[model samples]
Target chain A: MNLAQLQQAFRRWLVNASDESAQLLGSNHVGLAVYQNNYRAQLVGCLEQAFPNLRRWLGEQAFLAASITHIDNHPPHAWTLDAYPEGFHATLKDVFPQNPDVHELAWIESALNEAFVAADAQPLALEALAELDWDTAVLQLTPSLRCHDLTTNAEAIWSALWQETCAPEAVMLEQAGGLLVWRRQFTSRLRQVDALELQAVQQVQADGSFAGLCEFLVQRLGEDAGVMQAGEYLAAWLGSELIVGVRDV
Target chain B: MSTSNPHFSGYGLGLRKEHYCDFLETSVPVDFVEVISENFMVAGGQPRHILRQVRERYPVALHGVSMSIGTAEGLDTDYLRRLKSLVDEIEPLFVSDHLSWSRSGGFNAHDLLPVPYTDEALDRVCANIHQAQDVLGRTMLFENPSSYLAFEGACMTEWEFITAMARRTGCELLLDVNNVFVSASNHGFDALAFLDGIPAERVRQVHLAGHSQGRDILIDSHDSPVCTGVWELYARAMQRLGPVATMIERDDEIPPLAELLQELSMARTLGAAL
Candidate 1:
């Protein structure tokens, strides 16, 4: 066979050592077995690195088994091992339908990884936000900012595992809420978001100008109270450096 | 490829996160440092920040593991683009990757998977190398990988395949002596003959690392110090190919900076003795 055909057959054999491939392997089949073992070990090692907290939460055996399954289904497409095991949380959900928290933990970990390498931008100062014309100004957020709505208490589990302390017992969320993740300088930070903040974040993401934001507030609260709440939320966002720029719309 | 060798030459070590601060704080006595190309392919992060700072003090060689040059489907142009951007930024002394395929069917196995030493495989590899050199506008060094298995219908030896590749593509060679020793021992071939087969002028860099012995075979696990047998082989290579860029690599179970420096010092002593 030619090189292309040989590579195709070898790829299949690596994934599953079938009888035909075994015969084609010819002498020193044990060497082929070593390649197979190294193939699995290296990929599993990459998954463990990408999701250390998830591995800790799941324990060694369960994590290794699940990662092996994930590898079979969704091999890495990117060149870097840092980018391996993408969409693993969805796989986790498939593997463990009863433990929804496992999937949530994976999501949180993945977002943190993203935040670590996201683009850099100097955040717009809080004082700058106050000077903007509330009626015409459009706020721009940091590019690294990410929000996720989850129904499990995954953040607590992540924090505990990260600290290397006794991890907290897993629990379901009382109500569906979300988390806010963004890079503050070189460090990535995560915090829980309430319903009001989630709605405001959604508005900002959907291209809500200051006027639209005040209107969103006025519709939720009375005109006077809405104006006050808008000011407070804007102040909080600017103070956190989540707001990176502003331009007049 | 440049007919001239690298201007800088001395013992070097693989840069790791544990030794990042060590490199930044004080000038490590090593002459140059090598880094994995994929780790620093980021837009903005501490890793890039650290690399920028570290590059100021020492020359770096970008060693890559995922080019998948032997794949029949084709090379990943996107990966090459990212790599070119990094090469432009780092201005490394050498840019190198393995002569093995890591990607097939749109999925990367992340290991240096071996390739058949047939004429067809050699053609594809030379084409990929030529294309990569054209895209980056710089010559690349292709390293030999430690193999656990050989194809049933290979047409030539590994050294023959590499020598032909270098002669045809005008690409230099990264002679991984530890990998030579590993593959030689695993496949029951003479390491000296493998070295003698290669045209020495094409060899631009040499890699020395450690391996582990499994029940039936040896694995190229670069976690420990260079073994005595590999060290003896390295001494032989130094005599045949002089003044090549050499490095001591340790990926897993990394020791302290001092231990690696000591190992690197041993390399210098051996080379000088020869």
Candidate 2:
């Protein structure tokens, strides 16, 4: 037989195998069944890791069903399972439209995985700040550090997942809050942040000189929000090792 | 980093997640460790950190299941990139992947699917291997996967195909002794002849694993201890091939480190005898 017929036979056997009565070697069928099932299972298991939130929101059966369906049309082209789930959200959103939370949940979960493997680096500590001359010191977050200004209460929902009790209402935070995800000491952590503080850090990180930051905040949040309060927030972030470095003056 | 020779990292066992803690807490005399590259390919994690610690001590060799050299769809680039990154990080003594393909198009069965030994198939496999070696910038090794079936179109014996692949592609062979036993049993081939036909220079590494029998066929299940027949094959392969880098794969029903070492020690003895 030529390679084409050989390829066809292998492909057919992979799809479905018959018993040994009609087979040249009975063992090939067994290997195909077990190997095929495990191969599909690897992708499904990777989806569980990449989209834990979607998995939780959709529950076990529905989530696995969605995963199984997605993989059927989009068998993994890459050997690394990490990249395979990169396109999962688009597929899930199309399949489960009525469940709008699915998109947000998938987004948060994917971002969480992203943050989890961002890079290996150290975050700035408060001690690093103490040595800085405050007037000229411009704090810079680590490259691995990212603050997600979310539109949905992803944090609360994720927190509820940790308790092994997942209820949507449990995450009924007043506003769609902001989130900060950063990797330090090779561990990833995420948390909700206040809106004013979120924008405050983002603005400074984008292009705020310390004095300019205070002036901008005075104009935007009213003079009643003192510069010291902003400094305190910065200090708190620094203490938690969220602030990684300081830009040159 | 501790230096390693491609042909010999002394005696090592397949790095099992089960015995990770054992290796971490205390150091044993095992010379090196083999890891399934797919398991620890991601950017960062406890798994990687542990792997880092392990690499600092023992020589690490990458054994991948997804290279799919036997497939007709050409080489998978994404898989090669990931494997390259792993090679950069781990610096395994000699990188190896299965001589099998698991998918074509979109349907990925994730099994170490067998490839037929036809001339066309051989050409594709050689081209893919050459492409893979070029990308990896190193001579890669391919293992003969345990088979469940043999197509009628087999142009030559499995050994003939592997030897031709190695010779054609400038790749090395990872002589999986257990696979020989399993395939020989399932397909009624002589395992010793399978060893005899392959050029010894091509075998840079050797694998010894355990297998279990199903209702009608024997499965290359890496569970339990290495069967007596597989041991005999290992001794024969080592005798013919001389001392090659040897390791054991115990993925299922993993025993304690001591037990695995006991088996590895026996291999060390066989390696020494050879």
Candidate 3:
């Protein structure tokens, strides 16, 4: 085989371990076995490292099974190993169809990983906000911020697992909320927020106007409470370093 | 493409996360530290923050594993761009990758897959090197990788391919001594001949690491202390490629920083004798 053809065959051998591809490469079974083992082992190690809390949550055997299934279905295409775990939630969804907790836990772990490495931005100083036009001002969130809808207490489970405490049993939340992950300075932070706060944050992310967020909350929670809640969330987000910039639209 | 890289003779260690506090908080008695370029290639956060702090203390080298120069298709521009942004910031002592292919056909294996030592493969690697050098605006050091398999090909030896690649592309060489020993043991080739064949002046850096004995092959596992056999080979290498920048690379089962520094001192003692 030529160069491209040879590489394609190697890819096949690594991804599938097919005998045909191996034969085409020549009689090197011992060597090919080494490569095959290295390929799968490296990927397994990547998943294991990326989702340590997920591994603990699912137990060892179940997590390994899920990882194997994911590896079998999805051959990696990204240039960096960090991108490999981004698709693992899909596999978790398929493997644990009844367990939304597992899916959300995976989402939480993956989002935290992404937020840890997302682009750096300076938090907007509270002094800068003093001169802003609330009506036409646009608020820019930190690039590292990631938000996801939540239906289960995966956040609590993840937190307990992280702290090495006895995790509470997974259960469906009476009122679903949201999970937010972002970096403050050098530390990645995760927070579980109420549904209203989640919606307000998402609306602000989409629209980025103080008035727009106020209007969004006003429709959800009457005018007086809505505006008050908006100011509260703004103070909380600013304290958490989530708001990176404020610009006049 | 720039071929000549200024030579610096010093002993250093691969800066892994395990010893980040040791390197950042206290003054490690090493001339330089090498970091995995891909690890710091991210957009932001603690990895970059820690690297910046470390960079302030010691001269750093950017050692990458994802630059699959042996790919038959071509180079990855996005990877190069991210790497260039980092290079501009760190101004690393040396930027290097392996003479192996981890990516092809848009599927990355994330392991250093072997490259057939054929004339066609040589040409392709040279072209890729040229592209990478042109993009980074600096010559890169390509190291010899440990291999478990050797293809049945109609071409020259590994060193011959490397010699031709350096000559044609104006790139430097990162002579991985442990890789040479591992590949030689696995493929049943004369390690000395492989060493004697490469251009000594072109070599700018050296890597000494530990390996494991597999069922039928020696794996470049880099987990244990540097073995006697590899150390002997490194001594021989230093005798030939005098005063080259050398470092100990421990990736898995990392021990305390003091143990690695002790191993690095072995390299220093050997280099001082040379």
Per-residue error for A209 in candidate 3, Å, reads 0.9
Docking class of 2: acceptable
Which parts of model 1 are misplaced by more than 4 Å?
A: A126-131, B1-5
Predicted structure with the largest TM-score when compared to the true one: 3
lDDT (10s digit) by residue, model 2, range B1-274: 1122266737789888788877778887787789988877776656688899999888888888877787787767877887889898787888889888866764445668778787888899988888888888888889999987676657799999988887788788888999999899988999999999998887888889999987677888898899898888888888898877888899888988889999998899887886
Could you tell me the lDDT of residue A43 within candidate 1?
Answer: 84
lDDT of 1 at A178: 83
The 10-residue segment of model 3 chain A with minimum total lDDT is A125-134
Model 1: per-residue lDDT, tens digit, A9-86?
Answer: 666667776767766666457787887787788888878988999999999999999998987877577778777756
Candidate 3 lDDT over residue span B1-274, tens digit each: 4647789998899999989999989999999999999999999999999999999999999999999999999988999999999999999999999999988888999999999999899989988998999999999999999998888874889999899999899899999999999999998999999889999999999999999989988999999999999899999998999999999999999999999999999999999997
- Candidate number of the best lDDT: 3
Q: Which stretches of candidate 2 lie over 4 Å from their true place?
A: A1-32, A49-59, A90-109, A125-140, A146-157, A160-171, A196-220, A223-233, B1-6, B71-82, B85-89, B102-110, B269-274
Per-residue C-alpha lDDT of model 1 across residues B131-153, encoded as one tens digit per residue: 88888888789999999888777
Please give the range of 10 consecutive residues that has the lowest summed lDDT in model 3 chain B: B1-10
True contacts kept of each: 0.73, 0.46, 0.89
lDDT value, candidate 1, whole model? 0.86
Q: What would the per-residue lDDT of candidate 2 be over residues A1-249, giving only the tens digit for each residue?
A: 455444455555544444432254334555556555565767888899887766876789999988877876666655666678888877887788755456667766776677666656566655555566667767666555566666666666776775677555533346655777766666777777887778777877786456666776787767767576677777677766766677558
Q: Which clashing pairs does model 1 show?
A: none
Position B60, candidate 2: lDDT: 87
